[model samples]
Target: MLIQALTPADKSPLLALARRIADAGCNLSESRVSTIGTEVSLMLLASGAWDALAKLETALTKLARDESLRLVHYRTGQRGNSAQLPYLVEVVAADRPGIVARIVEFFAQHEISVEQLNSTRYRAMQTGAEMFQAQFTIGIPADIHIAALRDDFLELCDGMNLDAIMDPVKF
Candidate 1:
């Protein structure tokens, strides 16, 4: 468990902290962020025992203090069960807002749980339009219909002028 106090107006510091956490060889478990007036609080969970992660914890605390943020707590091993789904979905399209919302909504409607989601934006070769790529690792129940999901995503791609590729997650 890691605690950080920040302000939404100072997002750079928070993001920098997140990056540092990643560099510290700890897997981020969960992040809960809330804002009140000009202050924001972030509660993060990472993998590792307190003693084992002491150096990292101290560094994070120092960084937080330097940024005028508060260090709340430092602990470890706090996370929920992850989905055991067997497939992944990759979607690429022109950069635009609401893409993630729509994709998540689609998955929700189908009762598919997202296990991991990573997205990036880059320049497209053809049109130079900002291209957005999202890779979703999801958990599909054994009883769920794959054909329906494929068809729905296909139709969605058609409507959005994007490309969606479904791939099986290899064990």
Candidate 2:
């Protein structure tokens, strides 16, 4: 099952949620928790027998009501094995709009799948200049020509005055 919760940022809520999942006889398979602005967002994947899952659902409902959380949950299946190779793409450049959109478009045009992406803008400490950085985990089809793809990607980045690298993930 997949569970997502959003609540006012607090240190205790995560532990409380985890405890409830455990107490309900569910095993947490994966989780992502982040503090965005003043809210804490949680995404969790839990696995167990049907009864345990049902118990977890009940527990989650009670917890949400008690703690005033915005919650969403649903049953989900696991990802199928893929024949694509994993690669990491990193970009760094002066902060500007549409950079992420352009990068995503490039990968989409090549039929590559972006499995994960994280991007942030911040002021550089040294010069107090605004900077943008992004990291993408992409799945490249086995039949794609790696060198050609890298070349095209670099060309695009160069055109935008961005520093970028695309390399195979190591383990």
For model 1, residues 140-159, the per-residue Cα lDDT tens digits are 87787788878888899889
Root-mean-square deviation of every model: 7.2, 1.6
Per-residue lDDT tens digits of candidate 2, residues 1-171?
999988888643778778978998999999988787788888999999999999999988877775568888888998889799999999999999999999999999999999888888899999999999999999999999999999999999999999999999999
TM-score of each: 0.57, 0.91
Question: How close to the true structure is residue 31 of candidate 1, measured as C-alpha lDDT?
Answer: 80
- List candidate 2 stretches off by more than 4 Å: none
Most TM-score-accurate candidate:
2
The lDDT per prediction is 0.74, 0.91
lDDT of 1: 0.74
Query: Model 2 has how many clashing residue pairs?
Result: 0
lDDT of 2 at 25: 93
